[model samples]
Target chain A: MARHAQKWRDAPALNSGDEVNKASQSMEARVINPRSALLSNYEVLSLLQELEADHLARTKIAHRIKKEEEAAGTDVSVPIGGGRPSTAVETLENLRTVSFEAIKYLSADHQSTTSQTPEAVTELVKSLESYGFTKAEKLQIVNLAPQEQIELYVIVEELEDRLSQEQMVEVAEHVKKSLAAAPSLSIVAQPSHKPLIVKADENWDATDDVDEEFDDQGEGAGVEGDLDMEED
Target chain B: MFNLAILKDTVAVHPADFGTPQELAIMTELNKKYANRVLHDVGLCICVFDLTEAGEGKVRYGDGFLWYKVVFRMLVFRPFQTEVLLAKVMSSDHNGVRLSLDFFDDIYVPIHYLPVPNAFDPNERAHFWHASGDAEAKQTELLDTPVTERMWIDKGEIVRVRVEGDEFYDDEPGPVKMAEGVQVVKEVQTRAPFTIFASMAEQGLGPVSWWATAQPEDGEEQDEIMEDG
Candidate 1:
């Protein structure tokens, strides 16, 4: 009991230190003021401590609710954090860190050895995402073991293959009709958009002179018309 | 330009005792043994025939024996090559540069070994390769595309190389397969930038320095954390 209490004490210190360090590093990257930047580390650590406490409290509450549900001999509709109850598998995944012992718990619950691997769970989640599964649905799938992942992979693969086969037939029909009407020539030549005739330098010079004279005459007429209108 | 007596003695002496005085002291020994003999240069090539026994030492070449091969004016001596990782850089002092290698061997590289007109700055990190000189583009690809500009350890620079993955060598240990989400395209040349970690940790080739990433002093300073842990 003493050793267990000591472990709990050490956990808070190490976790807080890591959290503070990571937060400080991230803040130091963006904060410009030297004084404010130093204080940010303290603020981040305080926030982390609060979050850790809250998480502990929530876990305790969840444990109590689960125990009540088990005693009641009915499906426990205990809302896990604002939503449905999380399975044992989901709870393990939320830890982020790989727990090698997670396989045993999953095998016991699922009664299937194949559904208890991290790889299987990851694959299952990926497949669920591909199948347009909601975030919560994907999360549920992600909480599974390797066996579950394999099952999800197989199911997703079969569905995708069927959908693609149907789409391919439709695409083939569309392409066939479109090509039949596409003007078929013996050579299948594309018409050139570039001008064939190149203008001579003399013609360019003449055009430039005419444009300059026309601009000058138009300006003179505009000024004369403005003068006449003002006099009237 | 050639010393006839020295040349004759070198050829007469056995290669096994290539560095001994018997092979080198031909002129001095000749004078001491027989003062009345007169010697003349017989062109560049002189065949000295000994009256008694062909000379106590003659030349031979084998392993552990130093043999001189005359290629034009230069003499070539074969030296063994060993590959070692840059383990640690000892503090720089006026005495010279010292290095501890992963092979548990420490060596002091004198100023002469350092290439003159060093292109890298004092603060800039450098990388060192087992093979020196400019790197040949052995292979290239546009995969994983570096998120930022990349730098590497040039030859002779002290840099960090993570040992989590396989060690870098010329030969492949397993069949090379394209990684996930990567495709090999033909007729297209690839040139992708790589981070220091990718080069050393993933590719298994480097002692790449991370000085540019805002933690230059942390290279040696991390020892404190390690000690605490």
Candidate 2:
């Protein structure tokens, strides 16, 4: 109970501070450097999860306190100032909403974040060091976990010129291994978009050889797809 | 997708908050001011990362609040140009497709940025790509295929897109005026402060299901052999 009281008291003096800053024109906030560092999706996801857990705990404690006050016959419904909630309460609510939305977005099925861990991600980075990929390219590779050479081509520019076919295959294998080693957590319900099943003989022409190569590396993903089909 | 931005702000701490630690009080004040808000060009601010420096507090003549100049780092949601990202389709129209990251929903993939030979189906209210039987020729030409064969980018489907650009609008509130005898309330136009432009024209960048691994003929043959055995 004492801890819960401290949480509300921790709300800053935003109302008065804003008023002061508005009155003094010279005190306007400014950006020093817009891009000081880059943060990966995993970093942001873990941080938000921590913040959300804390917010939920505090909310539950606050609700219990309100119920107790009501049982004691104290009127707890009165607003602190006339009929308006305090700015502190409003700020906390804003934080809760923003964090919740961000978490949902990051945990979407398209993102491979749920199966990623700090150790696996770090190891993947170390293994990718030899490829000499740009920072942005490396980040995207880690974020997407592309299983096929074509998918890697999308993230890494000029794939044909930069790396040979064998090297590309090796990179995809590394990503697959890392992802497999990590424990998977289903954060969001997977969208029930049925797999587009293409008959093997329907389009078996010169393109079949190329697709066979893609299928070879993505065998792990193919097995998973088969499992989903079986369940259905 | 997230960048750390360093910003400087003058924080005013009231006497009522003096009981708390100095840094905690200042951090609370900063978060209240910046969290979940969009800066003009920096992108959407998420939350404060850490404080770098805080100058000595100064007291004003009239107000009892102490003001301090603080420099801090904050997390900002700003994807780089040409960066590939995954987003869910929010809606579709003649204009194009609107995407959402859930928190930030002002993403638009213009019609031209979509794959070529695409047509908007008013009846279904979604766009369909006229894919050809030949995988190589699908992007260049439209084949006269049946409706069931075409690829439809329906609502709620996840798609991979490349970030093309971003726009920021500085919309300041206009001054209020009294007209004639009645006080006319001016209708304010609400626009997103920041919007991202994305594209899905490239290969390996479309619906996730489209790129799902194709089962090899050899694997299927192996299954048939096992059944016979």
Candidate 3:
């Protein structure tokens, strides 16, 4: 009779153990399989939010870089061929400035027999153009002296004998004087163009008055002419 | 075909052991062309040698003395030709020089390149050309003459050779091959280190120095020594 009572107690314990096992298996199954659509939606939403936040951060970084560049006034756009623009006004200015500097150093003292003042040279250029001289001949005349300019004019007019005898003699004398002057100026202005015009100002006379004082002070020592030219 | 080194009929070699007659001839010609030549400008001749050997003691990667040799066969011979022009002496001294060329170029020969004349005659045109700047020249013509030349030059003197195989002293050498219709002129002016330095100190551009008539202390010392003697 006691044994039968013990068996009854054991049977209830066994039944409880089976029930616990069943509950555990149900929990495992729920975890392994997605039973509800709500959890999936929550996970997907979380992932999308993370990606959006990363994208926003990257965009903010790019915007900040752009803003900083704008503030500094830097043109960061790459050219088609990765070359600096050739049409820059600064480059043209630099070239003109250099040319002007070269012209400035040219001096009358440095002039050779072939050298002429800037004004004389310009006049010769105009004359040569009017006479329809060859480009090379015109260029050569422009680089010549006042005397040479006269000679070239006569020679071009003569066309190797077209000019009158008087013109020929006059031109020849001018050429001789120019040739004689060549040695003096050539020695001083070696490798330099002659009759260098440093400054071109219509109001140069006003400043030239002051320049005489400057010359007396030896400030304009190597200048072409002093105040005496003004007295003339 | 020629033997690279002629033997005195002293040795006998099997036909298989000796190099071919053509090979020997090639070696002989190469040796004759390159034997005494020195490595001039490695930087300018980079196309001939490996780029890695520049500035290093090694001339070429393959053989000895290969880098020192200039292949003269590849060069063209343009004869010495120039038009001589008469020019008047403006002003010249040991320090600076200015002369006109065809009234076109007023070439300024500064102190360093002023060709000093050892001896000259005032009446002689060549002598005048040589000694115009020298104070010793009592008289000089006052005129401009033009000169032209196509040839090798050394120390401002025209050399007899039509083609210069090596321009070792030039700061910049001419083109390797002067193509037809293309003429690129190269000029090099050498100045004393002190002069260059002084010019730089005074102005950005190289201008002639201001003339000072008084002699320096060194000149005074020489004068005193002369007096004592």
Q: Pick the candidate with the highest TM-score.
A: 2
Q: lDDT of all predictions, in order shown?
A: 0.28, 0.71, 0.27
Q: After superposition, which runs of candidate 1 have C-alpha atoms over 4 Å from their true positions?
A: A1-39, A78-83, A86-232, B1-229
lDDT string for model 3 (B1-229, tens) is 0001111111112222122232222223332332222223211100000011112122222233222111111110111111111222344443443443221123334443332322222223222233223434332322122121100011222111111121334344545545586765545575211111011111111111101111212334433432432
Task: In model 3, state the lDDT of residue A25.
Answer: 49
Q: Could you estimate the TM-score for every candidate?
A: 0.16, 0.74, 0.21
- For model 1, residues A1-232, the per-residue Cα lDDT tens digits are 9999999999978987886675444322111111111111112222222222222332333343455557778544444344434311112121111111121222232222222232333344444443454443333223321122222332232434544654434433332332343232211012211111011111222234333443333223313223222111
For residue B91, what is the lDDT in candidate 3? 43
Candidate 1 matches the true fold with a TM-score of 0.16
**What is the model-wide C-alpha lDDT for candidate 2?**
0.71
In angstroms, give how far residue B130 of model 2 lies from its true place. Answer: 0.9
What TM value does chain A in model 3 reach? 0.23
Candidate 2 lDDT over B1-229, as tens digits, reads 8999999998998775564457766876887888788898899988777788999988876788989899998889999999989998899998899999998999999988987668677777887666544544443243345565567777888888999999998888766677987777878888889999999888877666556553222334433432432
Segments of candidate 3 deviating more than 4 angstroms = A1-105, A110-120, A130-132, A146-232, B1-229
Q: Each candidate's DockQ score against the native complex?
A: 0.01, 0.28, 0.01
DockQ of 1: 0.01
What is the Å distance of residue B229 in model 1 from its true position?
7.4
Instruction: Show model 2 residue runs off by greater than 4 Å.
Output: A1-26, A58-91, A184-232, B133-145, B181-189, B214-229
**Lowest-lDDT window of 10 residues in candidate 3 chain B?**
B43-52
